[model samples]
Every structure is written in structure tokens, then in C-alpha cells.
Target: MRRHRSSREIAAAVFFAGLACATLGGMGQRCLPVAVVGHLCVDLAPRLREAAVLEPGRLFDVGPLGVSLGGCVANTGSRLLELGVDAHLAATVGDDDLAEVVRAAALRSFGERVTLDVEPGAGTSYSVVVEPPGQDRTFWHHSGANDAFTGGTLPPGDVVHVGYPSLLPGLLAKDGTPLLDLLRRASARGSTTSLDLAVVDEKSAAGQRDWADLFARVLPLVDVLSPSLDDLLSALRIDPGTTPRLDLADELAGRLLGWGAAVAVVSAGAEGLVVRTAGRERLERAGSALAPRAEAWAGRRFRRPVIAPRRIVSTNGAGDAATAGLLAAVAAGADPETAALVAVTVAATVIAGDRVTPTLLEDLVTPAPTTPSAPGDPAAGAAPSAPLLLPANQPRGRFYRGGAAIGAFRGTGAAEEFTPEDWVGSVTCVRGEPGIGETSLPDGVRLRDAVAADPEGWLGAAHVAAFGADTKLLVKLLDAGQRLPVHAHPHDDFAQTHCGTAHGKAEAWYILSPGEVWLGLARDLDAETLGRLVTEQDIDTLLGAMHRIPVAAGDRVYVPPGVLHAIGQGILLAEVQEPEDLSILLEWRDFELDGATDGHLDLGFPLALSAVEHSARSREQVEALLTRADDPGPGLPVAAEEYFRLDRHDVRGSAELEAGFAILVVTEGPLEIGGVPAPAGSTLLVAAAAGGLTVRGNGELLACRPPVAR
Candidate 1:
């Protein structure tokens, strides 16, 4: 029987495969180079109102003119760079003043990989992009230097991408012989040949040629062909009136495959990507980078729907971004489904005005690392051996208010608005976000990277043996300026089964200021009624339904997963929880956030509400979850001991601390730990290698650690 592979193993296999390909020719190169050869230009977009008057000689006030690089070399190449690929530009520009602008923009990311053939006595290509509010963009383009391009001097890379063939007049001069030769040369070098097309303008001279003949001649040499649906229809001179988009895409992809291409990827705007591949024999010939996974890639067809962003900016480069993602994943040996998913994900980042990263792509292929450590880990030397100070890591753009308390506590002056939580010593990021909520050390290293690099050194041998590099803990200082939105988190079972995550959120709070907090259900209620109450935005009933308890400084409260709770205004606390940011908000009215859109964690209300605890908790049971900070032994209740451990050490004169991987927050201190002056409000990370440490001073210290690794 064939051995089954876990997601982690698959991710590791693909990552190593990509690593081997990255060092092509054994010259010790770290990144695989992808050559983007075609159509480079400058774009100047001036935003106008929806009803702007545009008569011949009339001038209207508009927003700033956004000047940026355009065409395939910029859109697709820059996107590839953002995905951590080394994209080399092999295009042309005229020897004019505008060439400097193109050079400046392209060199910022592509660096020396930009090989611009300066065509003397010709003007550089440019486009005036007219984008009105809530309308598709229109371009006034000048072919300029692009008309003189001959597809010569292609960058020496593993993949050669010829983009926007419809815009290159020279390539279309002789039945696309020049374009055909370019693909042949690239294929002869064992490099993967990819092609992309622009929408054909029937009135243009290049567009008036036989495009079907051109594609037929060149596609046999092409391994990957990505084209927009409309472009494909226009190039082939075919029209399908009222045909379902998926069916149309299927028909076109099949035609492309039949024409001898290894794979055809069709972009249907917001409908996402449609992918079709040839059988194993042809797939094995796709390229060295993709051949190893030919068995998985062979004869596959699927459509990946777009994962919508929180807000849509301009849909300008969404298609190119999708192509970049598809190519990068293919080079990394991802299967068709995963490649399509990465394609859509990258497009969504472009829509949301965000940049893509390799970490984001890796998350789609595997969960966080949680397997046992290997023999002789390579990253152990990079782990922290001594305690490091963590600067304030308060993320902005929260719906709630209040950061003054956190700002004062961390000794950081003048906190900005919407910055409410300080994630201290955190190795986890916000849900659906890879780099946002993680903590950074003083020297600009991300805590997550450090912990991942040396799990044994940072997390201890036993912890690494059990939990891999997963810190399994998140520490935060949340300052609630206004009453928090009623919310609940799913437990581990629901999170893993339905949410595709490793941990659910079970949190405990160490109160620093007095406030009234809502906890647990006041009475038993059915799931249907609970859903109804949430849908109606019945704030009064929702708050009244939970037991309200007063909390003071030095009080500890344990909040289990699935329990609905809210922190009252004017409360400041240090919290520890499972390393996740999964919250299902029950109410968001009167807050800056839109509850109807964002409250459900992307799982619609009906399904999300099922994760809530509907059974009532008696007053006695609720009280049992709380404990005084001055209580004997552990700081929190016994139930929380399984998730995390918080210990308060009171120092009258001096004390000795048992060293481990933990976060130390000086609660009330004008004290010193191992000769470092840890005054009130200082936070420090203690690595296990630090061993037993001597603490001297008169104050209180709270050490937060992950649950004992069993």
C-alpha cells in the first residue's frame, strides 16, 4: 500500500523541490529567475468623479495623478517579485526622457535583472488611464517603443513569459514568426515557455491580422498559456452569446490544449481562474520545475472562485497578479487546485491594496509547523540564547478605542488612535493574516521567525518534541476604552474540523484595572433564538442574557472556548490564550466595524453561531472560573493550567527564578532581573537556555509560559 502524506510533509516536499530548482545550474543562486519579456510602459491615472464632465476643451478638478509602471513587465513581474520570485525584465524602452521613469520604477524591485533595450529615435510607450468612480478603467495608449520590439535578448532564466502579444506590432509582422522563434529558443533551452495576451482591438493594425493562425503556430512551443476570457474570444474571432462562463472557459481551454499547449489558464474577471491541463506525457514535458509533479498535474480541470477582499480598491492588475501566483506555485510544484487557490489569493491581495509574501503562499499549502523536531536541526544556532527585550507591538485599525493605558504601561509615548492591543512576545499572527499580529524583537527580527528557526533553543527540547515550533501561546495587553463587542471563540475541535486551523481560542485575563465584565449565559437558550437575537442587533437582550460580574485589579478570569463574553470599558488587562485570533462577534452596532460583513469569521452566521455555548452557566460555576492574583500556587483557575501557566512572583528583597521559555511582564516593579533594570511596565522574553536567573528588587513580576509540553 502507498504511504499517506500529511499536509506538512507535502509542503516540505514541495518546498525542497522548489529549493532544488532555485539553484539551477548549481551556481549557488537562492531564487529561481522568471523572465518577463514584452510590453513595458508608463501609466498615469487621474481619478475622476462618476459624473465628471469631459467635453473637448473643458477642464475638471480631479484627484492626484498616480504615476506608475504598466504592462506585463511591471504588473506581472513586480507581482512575481512580491511572491518571492526573482522576476527579470526583458523588454524595451525608447531613448527618451520617459525611459528614465520606467527604469527608476522597474529597478526598484527587479534591480539588475531589468534589461531594457533602448530604441533610439523612438518615443517610450505610455498610457493615460482614465478611472472614474465605480467604473471600469479606459486607456489611451501609444505603442511607441513597443512597436519596435523584436523579442530579442530574452533574459536567461528558467521560465520565459511573453506577454501582451496583441500589442507588439513587430512580433505580428510576419505571421508571428518572430514570436514563434522566441518560444522555440526558450523551449530549446529547457526553459518553460509561457504566453499571455492583451485584449485585441479590432481597429488596430496588429489586431486586424490572423490571430488564430498566430496562436496556432506559437502555442505548440508554449508550456503555459494564460489569457483573459474576452481576449481569447477576440483573438479566436469567436462569440458565444449568453453561454455560462465556466462552460465557455472549458471550451476555450480545451481548444488551447488541443492546439498542443500543456496547460491553459483562463481568467474570467471576478469569476476567478479556470485551469485545464494535458495528460501525463505532455505534462512531463512542461518543464523541469513542474515535471516532478506531472502525475498530479496530468489531466486536471477545475475552477477556483475568488476570495473577496474586505474592500475592493481598483481591479487594475488583478489578472496579472493571478498569473503571477499561478506561475510561482507551478514552479514550486503545487497541484492544480493549490495553484488555482494561490492564484485567487494573490489576486485578492492586489484588490485589497496589500502585497503578497511567500509566508502567505506557504500557509495555503500547509498548517503551522507542529510535527516533531528532526535530528540535528539547522536553525538551532539562530535561536535566542539570552533574554531579549520586546518593543511595543500594538497593531492599529481596531474597531474599539483606547490605547492610552497600554501606551503608559509599555513606556511608549502617545499611542495612535485605534491601537488597542499590545501583543507581547507573540509568535502568532491575526487570523487570515500571516505577518500582521506577530511580535518583532528589538533588532528587527520577527518573533515567529526566530521561534521557527530554533524551536529547541527557544521552546525547549520537550516542547519541540511535542509541538514542533508552535509557541502554542499568545500574550496581549488589551485596553478596552469602550465596552467590547460581544464575542465568542470556537474550541479546538470546531476550529480544526470547520475552520482549517490548529488551535481554538481559550483565554485568561489578569486584570490590571477594575471593571464589570459580561461572562457566560444567564439562562438556557436554543441556537435558533440566539441567532435571532444576534441578527436583530438586540444589544440590550444580548448583554442582559450574560452574567455580569465585577472584576478588580489582581483578579484572574478564565474564559473557555465557545463562551460568550465582553470586556467593559476602562478595563486594562494582560491576557494569555491559544495562539489564534478567531473571534465570532455577536454585536458590532455603534462601533467602527461593520458587523454584518465581518462578524462571522467568514463562516456565515448560521454556521458560526453553532460554535457558541448556548447552555446557561450558574453564578457558582461562573465564580469558580475566577481567582485572585494573590491566590496560592497558580495565578488562574486549575482549568487554565492545561492551556497556559501564569505565576506572580513577589520580591521583597531578592529571588531566584527557574528559567524557561516565557514572557515576563513587570507588573509593579522598580526592580532588576539578572542586572537588567526592569522597571514598572517593561516586558522581556526569557529563553530556556538562560537557565535559573537571580531577580533582585522590591516589586511584582508575572511570568507567562505555554502549557507544559507532554
Candidate 2:
């Protein structure tokens, strides 16, 4: 039987296979000829330690310094070569020390494919990159010889990519006349023409020009126009202050299409790439590269979320890398969706301090074929196990408000208001909502199905022996946009006896944002009063009954079954819970949800109210439920061991972790877990087969796992 494949895998295969075709014409031994033109510079990057601070007249300690090639020709052209494409670089530099550095870097990678125009007496461009730990990099750039670079002769190639027009003042001068001329020449040669723009200083002369007018004149000849959202916004003089990023991308892409570009791609950092293409007629004129599939490429609109990198070193050349990937895919005749995926994947590898190797690209997009086990065998198709990257599974039309925080955290673009909870590696569905909260892998296989196929591989032999195929763990990224209604969940015994469920909901939260939480009752109340509170919906008195405690990032709070609690508003948290979702709503006023109908797990409020913990608890008792960020091991309370387990690791140099079936969440910094680059705000699922993982680099990670087998 054939193995199931994801659209991503198919796209990757199609892209690479198309590159291998001889119909596109080859350069030397390499297919898919691409020409990368525009800014070239030397980058001097100084890495900083966590303790290092940037202050005037104050020197701080630093890590190793790195000298590398920067700008479009260096970043994009080199990436194209790495992806097995023949990329010829056409860029200008000066006869200076920095020029030598640029030459060495370029020649070392591209060899004869590099063409450098050395301007006499002119200085080569350079950038001083001030990159701090766990922060975006700041560049102090000098556009030296780049300013002297007029439109050069087009390199002979199937696709010509001109980049960083904002940095090349020569092109931006005369209202982008030189750029238009170059694109026109490339188009006339029947070559695909692509353009990329750099971030421009608002006060610079290039930024002061009428960019809208310039693009209007130049875009007609350009086949592909890809620019960073910020740069596009700046060029169009659009203030997207509070507009959602996806919406903004749509608007920008519309304008670019209106300006006559064959395709418009907005590289929205974190949100990934937003691509919109022109009609069939316009796409037909795009160039020889896209001519084969112009019909499939026309009038398509989609957004590709940024693929989480193994780790993020620096985002310096990511945009350029993405442009290279897009151009490569276009040269190979890939459909728009496949092309976007390829672009994002390539950019991810760039950020992870690595380039996309053919093998790595295949591993990322292709699903491994597995031999089917004997009939009736549960452990059927889970072999050659590796870590699976889980995308954010935020369900929509939820009762709560807020998902924008989750979207921001996951870099998946703006989420709807009701999608406040992100279910990660989830096998359990919402109570009474089958298939609602269960997570589906990128390959379209359900986590439940994968676990079922190879229980021993996914859950370990010992775990499967003890708990069958049950994961018993449900992880979530929760954003309380508004104060949650006071509620409580039934204990296992109560659930089994009344609700007929296998397990009750015993959950814990690892705070990611600061806020207050109500847990347990401050004073004792009779069952009649608690029942009356639910019956009468007395919101004030019910909330006053519980102890309100403050929480901050890294703090862990354990909520035992039957404990009445409510998560406060303006707080974002990572939650680990039992595999069931059963809550007894005690208060639900002022919320959009019809609590009277849906809040009580369908058992009716009268029966569900019996599960509430009405006993009075002292301040000390309530405080014991919380654990500080600096708490030793296993952030959650010991009581939580019966349900799930969570361990917080503050890795500095290196740490070795025992192999297990676990979900690793990188909370801060860039680090490698089991040879995977795990950047901050990324989640990775480590299988039992990935044994003895070693964590390198500085970062904070939370390892969430199922409880030990009995």
C-alpha cells in the first residue's frame, strides 16, 4: 500500500523534481538557472551574551564575532546554490578591504557564478550587526558602492531577481527608472523577473521618493514582486497601526496586483508569506519560467504560515532567502501554494543557522513509508520514529474571547476572537464535541491515528502496557482575553459515577503572562448557598468566595479536580491537563456564551453543581497550589503526577535529557533539543525512539509528558 503524503511533501517533491527537468534549460550541471542582482555587503556580526547590555559609553562582554556576506546577492544567491540551483550573482562592490571580504565570501560559495563589478576608489558596503540574545538584530548599514550601481546588464538566466532597490540608490533615483529598465530588459528576454525591497530609512532620500508611482511604472515588467510587509507599508505610505497583519497583507497584495505585477508576495515576519497572483493573461506574460503553469498560477490567493525553525540564530537574511526559494520554485514551474511552502521552508532553515540541504528538505516535507503490521495488530505503522512539529491547533467558535495572543505567540497571523486556546499534541476532543480539539499532524494524519498505529513507538512499551493507547496528557496555549467564568471540574470518581467519563479534568497552568487567578474558596459556604449561587447566578458573591492570587511568567499553578477556579483576563498560559474536558460552570455572566445551555457539560447544572469544592481554604492552603518560576524540578505540584508531568529546564551551556515520549516547548531563546533547532515560541514532539536528547545553547524549555506508567 502507498504511504499517505501531505500536500507539503508533494509540493516539495514537485518543486525539486521540476528543478531536475531539462526542459527549463540548465547552467553547467545545475538546472533552474537563477540570477540574483542588487545589493552586496560585508556583515560583521557580534554575538552578545544574556548579560550584555547596549548602553552608550559602556562596554559589555560579547561572544565570538562572525564576518559573513550580507545583502541580497550574498544571502539569496548563496541560498539558491545551497538548494542546488545555478544562481549567478550580479552585484557591485568597491576596490577596498571590505570588497575583498565580499569577494572571498561570494567566490567561496558561488565560484564562477559570481560576477562582481569593482568600482575604483569607491568603498564596499558593510553592516555592523548588533544581535543580542533572544532579540531581533539591529543593523548599522553603509550603502557605499551600492549607490554607484546603475542598472547593469542582465545575467543570462531563466529568472532574474533584482533585490534591495531601497538600498541601491542608483535604482531608486530618477523615480526607479533604472529598475524599470532592468526589469523591462529581463522581461523582453523572456526571463522571469523578480524584485525584492529592503527596509528604508524614513529620512533617507530613497524613502522620500514617490514609491507608489515608482512601482506603478516598474511592476508591469516584473513577474514577481516580494517585499517585507514593513517595507511595502513604508513604500506605499500605509499606516497599518491596528489592522490585522493578514488583512494588511491582502490590501498590500491588492495594490501590487493593481499596479500590474504578475504576482505579489508580502513577507510578513512570523505570519509567513502572503501571495496573490494576477489573472491568466497577465501571468501568461510573466516569463518563460512560469509560462508552463500560468493558468494554475493565476488569481490565486493564500497565506503560508512561517514554518518553525529548528532554532532561530538571526533573521538577518531570512527575507532574501525566502525570495530565493520563491524564485527557484517559479523557475521550476511550481504552483503558487507549493512555491509559497518552499519559500517559507527555505527561510526557516536559514533562521535555524542552517541551509536547506536536499536530504533535509526531503525529511521535512516527506512522510516516511512504513510497512504495515499483521492484521489486528495495534502497533502497525510507526517505524523510523522522529520528532513531529505540531502546528497551532486553535479551534474556532469557542465560548471564550481571545486567540490573538496565541496567534502572536505561534506567529500564525491574526486569529479570531473565540480561538483563545491552542491545543498542542492533543488526542482528546472537547467534551461532547468529537473531533473538535484533536490535533492533526502536518501530513493530515490525526495524532490519535498515529498513536494508535504504533502505540509502542509513540507512547513507549511501558506506557502502552500501563495505559493502553491513551496519551492521558492534553497540552494547551490558553489566552484569557477576558476573565473566565468561575467553574469546577469533577474528580475521576465523580465523573465515572455521574458523567460516565473515563477521567476527570485535572489541569495545571504554566504562566506565560502576568495576571491574577481565583483558586479554591476563601471562606466555607454551604451546598445550598453554592447551589443558590449557580441557580441565581450571583457573580459577585461567588467570585468573592474564592481566593484571588497573583501570578507571573514561569509560575506554575495546579488545579486539582473539583477545585473551583477561574483564569483571570489579560493572561496567557501554557496548560497541561488530563485527556478529558469536563467543566461545571458556576458563573457565566457578561460572556457571549449561553452558559445556561452549554456551560454545564450537558449533565445539567443541578447535577454538575455536586462536583464543586465548597470547603473553605486558608491563604496558606491556596498558596500551596502555586509554584514560583524558580522552583526546583517538575514545575507542577506533586499531586499532578497522577495525571501529567511538566519539567522546566533553564539550559545554559548544555543539558542531557533522558529519552521519553514528551512534548518540548521552547519558552525562550534559540537552542537545539535532540539535534533539532528549537527557537523560542516553538513546540516539538519528541518520540521515545528519539532517545537520549542533548540540549545545546541557552534557552528555557518546558517538557510536558504523560505520567509514569503504573
Candidate 3:
């Protein structure tokens, strides 16, 4: 008679099969996404009354009024997206006529990523800009829906652009729910933020003071803060008269930097611009033609422009355009000098045009190609790459092993198919097994079982002896499978006395294949009701109430001691755990492992009851533990603790390993270990003894370390 496999067996079989397929295939890399906030404002240039006086009854015709979306939501954000950046926009608007106009404009410019937060009866803001020659432009502005903009209207963005600070008074509300507070919240999640101050009148000086304090508070969190010299001096209360002429801009930049900006740029009209770093400043003169003629100066001297533009028109949004250019370059990982150059180029282009488009800018801007070069080259001009360390073939000294073995080599040897029977009887986990041994690990580490001749020498004799006593987690990469039991493990306090162990099981995984995984606290009870569930053998009801999630490869799932969880089919993963095996299985129905009742590992009924989690589960709470590799590239590091520090190292050619003790486990390709070829399934023990090793070759490696406390 043929025997039917248990649910655990079926699940294990499917997992391993899927894992094999993933080993042969590759996953695509992802980039960091971006988001923009604030409302789009249409600036009406010709409608201004000042234009009427300049043109004198000619209907104040100012070059077709140059209609386009402005504000953080449009100008800065749209430019980023057009530069191949993954960007989104979040802005408040009225559901009225202007809302439709702005919404349609945003949709046409940014597509679906633009989110319009609409409030009834609110009107979208608009501005009338008048350039009346020989002075800064005058603005007639209205803050419609913008005045009602609140914290709840904010959206998620990696780098937020808070534009036109004067218009965002609600953002500076004295109440705790300030919009700036919301921005702080977003920035706390690894997002960088920036602010743009508009030209304001002296009459609103008190309002300006409030805005200055707001800037001071938010500036520390901001990566870059760009404001014109005139606007900054007015807001900061710095009297140009009192300040010394020598290094005045440098001093101002230094103060701003001290407030937490990485860098600052001050634009001085006609005098050109000054970019100050932490230690030095670079001044780029205005284009030569724009500079005052030498003969006209009569002993007075003016700086000459480094590069002259072919033509010039309006400088209306030149600063804004330059700001967008600098931000875009920075977002693309360019260096400071390159970013500044890009900014200057962008500003010049905007000055020459009535309006700018992504296509036009892309066509005009030429980015130099970046290439990988040997380390220590000053002109190598690329972001530093990971180091490469070759492990020595011979031991530098005596090798000792007392640390717990987190990973091991399954074996080496190319095989066409993997069977349970073949794996069940294998004594040595090494190369030449019935599994693919050529594929690499997630990081740059290589894999393969230790040879029989060196098993004790490689894994330590003591480690092998304690294999039975120590918790053993078996990971079977699956292509298909049945659902296993929903379960939890006793807490450390309960386990020490009841199970003769101090630690309870807490495991996490990095999924290698995409599929559904069941997880959560088993019982549907609140914290108050948890004690009752534990008193009763309500395993079936508890498992039924837990949450089930469908996950994909490169996704991380964490299971705390009290969370009842089980992985479904089609997943290959690396599981980390505490050194204990105590568990409480809540579901046994449809399970075939060890006759459902006979061979299953079970916690005593009393102890099992004590382990039930009785609080309401939150999706956010769960996701906080699971790191998904949607953006920011493949083989990303998601989880870290003092107990263990884990990172995924993805390499194309070569990468450096930091100078510290870390175990490099190969999750993907054959890696060169100390000039020796080590295939997949091998775990190289990189000790502090290996100090500053170099890793070269293509593939991925998972670097693991003992919990920080150790």
C-alpha cells in the first residue's frame, strides 16, 4: 500500500522544489521611491496690475503669461519623475473648478502617482506675478485650500520638498498637530526633507519670525535648505550692514550647516552664486556677458562669468529650476560638484526659456559616464564599492570553534532532480549532492558541505556533538505544499522551568520564492481574554483565528515566541532562531507529520495556554517586522538585532568586506574564498581572524554575526 505524506512533509517537499527553481533564476533590482507634498499653484504673470503700467494699456502682455504648475507638487516633483526617478505627489486642493484644472494638469504631468487631497468648499491657491524691471518681481497671491492644509493631508515621500513656506501657516500652527510635525514623522523613517522659502514683505515680519523658528526646528532634519540671500537675511534677522564683508556668506553658510544642513548655496544676483561646504566655499561668477563691462567699472572690479550663455530671457523660476536640478542630481547619486554644475546648467536653461519640460532638460543635460576603477584613485569619481577579501588557503593560526553554527553546507555536486529519499539518507552535507550546487547565495558568500576529512576541523567536534541537544531548524525550499499547524512557543520564563531550557523559539526568514504564508497569534482573544484561551485546549479555534499572508521572494517574515505562524508552499528561506526547540502546536487537523498525534512536538496543555497572545494584532505592527525588497535594490539588509546582524551583499564584479568578524554564507553563486573556488551550499566561517578580507566575483552573500550582546 502506498503511504500518504503528512502536511509537514508535503510542505517541505514543495518548498525545496521552489527554492531550486529560484536558485537558477534571478531577481531584478529595485530603486528607492520618492514622494512630493503641497498643492500646485498656477502663476498668472500678465494678470498683474504692475504689468499694466509696464506695457501701458497693451493688456500687460508678458510673454503669454507662461502657464504651468508650480509649488512642490508640480515643478520640483515633476522634474524628478521626468529624470527617471520613482516619485509621487501629495497636495491639497478644492473640489471646485480650479481643483479640476490642477488635477488635470497633475494627471497629465505626473500620471497616477499624483494624489490630490480634496476638501469641500476650499479653493486652490493662485498667484499673479509682475516683473516690473530693475527690481524683484511683485506677487499678488491667494491661499485658498492651502490655508486649510493639515497634517492628515501629508503623503509619504523619501525626500519632501516644502515649497513657499509663507503660504503654509497651518503647517506652523502652535498646536501639536503641526504640518511640520507630520514632516518630522516622515523624515524619521529614513526620508530626507527640504524647504523652499518664498520672497515675503517686511509687513509680515512677525509671520516671518514664526516661519524662521519653524525652519530652525525642521532644518536639523533637512538634508538641504536653499533660500536666496535676501530672503534668508530678512528671515534670520542678520543685518548685512553689521556683518563683515569678508566671508559673510561663508559665515552664514557655516551657521546654517551647524544647524544640520549637509550643505548650503546662497544665490547673489549679478554677483553670481556661492556654494559653501563644511570647510571651504566655491564662488561661480555670473555668465561673462551678464557681468558689468570692465571699461564701465572705472577702477571697480566685478567677477567674470566662467561660462557665458548664448541667450537670456526671464530669470523668473531660475532659482527654482536650479533647486530642482540640484535635487535631481543628488537623488541620482551625483557628487557635490556635479550637482552644482547640473544646477547651474538647469538655471541657465530656465533663464533662456518661458517654460521647461522634462524632455527638453533631458535633451540638454549631458551626464558623464561613471565607471568602476581601482580603489584609491582620486579621479575614480564613483561611489565607493563594497570591498573584496580573499580568504587565505592555509590558516594564519590555530582554528577553534565554540560559536553556534547558524548555517551549514548542504553538499556539492550538480544534480538534475532532488528527492526526499536521496536527501534522507545522506550523512555528509557537502558538494555533489542531489541538488544544484553551482548557484550562489544572496550575498557574496559561496556554499558547499565540508569534506568528511575535515568535518571536525571545519564545524568543530563540540558543535557536531551538541546537534541533538541544540535546537535544529530544518528549512525545506518548496515548490508546492500543504499547510502546517499554527503554533507558538513558550516564553523564556515558562520554558526554563517547564522545558528545562531558558530560551524560547523566535525565528525569522528571508523568503526565496513568492507565495502565501500563514502567521499570527493563534487565538482571537484580547490581552484580557488570553488567560482564558490558555486554560482551555482551544487550539483549533485559535489557529482558525490567526492571520494568513501571501508573501514573495526577498520578503522578510518574523515570528516572535508567542505568534502562531506557518509557511505555505512555494518558498525558499534562511531561518534564524534562538537555541531552543520548545513549541506549542495549536492545529493538528489535516496534518500528516508523525500521525497528527504521535510524533508531533507539543507543549504541555498548561504551558501552551500560557503562550497565547491575547491582544489585537495590527497590520502595521506585523509589517514593521517584515522587510520587503520592493525598492532600494536586491539582497537588501532588512533585519538586525544585537543578537544577530544580517546583511545581504549583492555584487557584480567585486566588493569589499568590512574589517570585522562576520560569517559569509553563500545564498547564490560560486564565490572565490581566499582564491579557492567555493560553490553554493557552502558556509565560510569568516572570523575576526580573517580580518578585512576581499571578496571578488559575481553573486550574493549574507553576512551574519552573533547578537550584539555577545
Lowest lDDT sum, 10 consecutive residues, model 3, at 282-291
Per-residue lDDT for 409-506 in model 1, tens only?
A: 65433455567888888877766557778875532356777677766778889988888888888889999989998999999999998888899889
Off by over 4 Å in 1: 1-31, 51-53, 366-710
What TM-score does each of the candidates earn? 0.48, 0.52, 0.47
Candidate 3 has a TM-score of: 0.47
- A best-first ranking of the candidates according to their lDDT comes to 1, 2, 3
The 10 consecutive residues of candidate 2 with the worst lDDT sum are 363-372
Highest TM-score model number: 2
> Mind giving the per-residue lDDT tens digits that candidate 3 earns over 597-688?
42123444544556656564776666666778674643323443522455677867777775443445566666765553444544454423
Worst 10 residues of 1 by lDDT: 366-375
Predict model 1's lDDT versus the native.
0.78
| Candidate 1 vs 3: which has more TM-score | 1
lDDT of 3: 0.49
Q: By TM-score, how accurate is candidate 1?
A: 0.48
Error of 3 at 459 (Å): 16
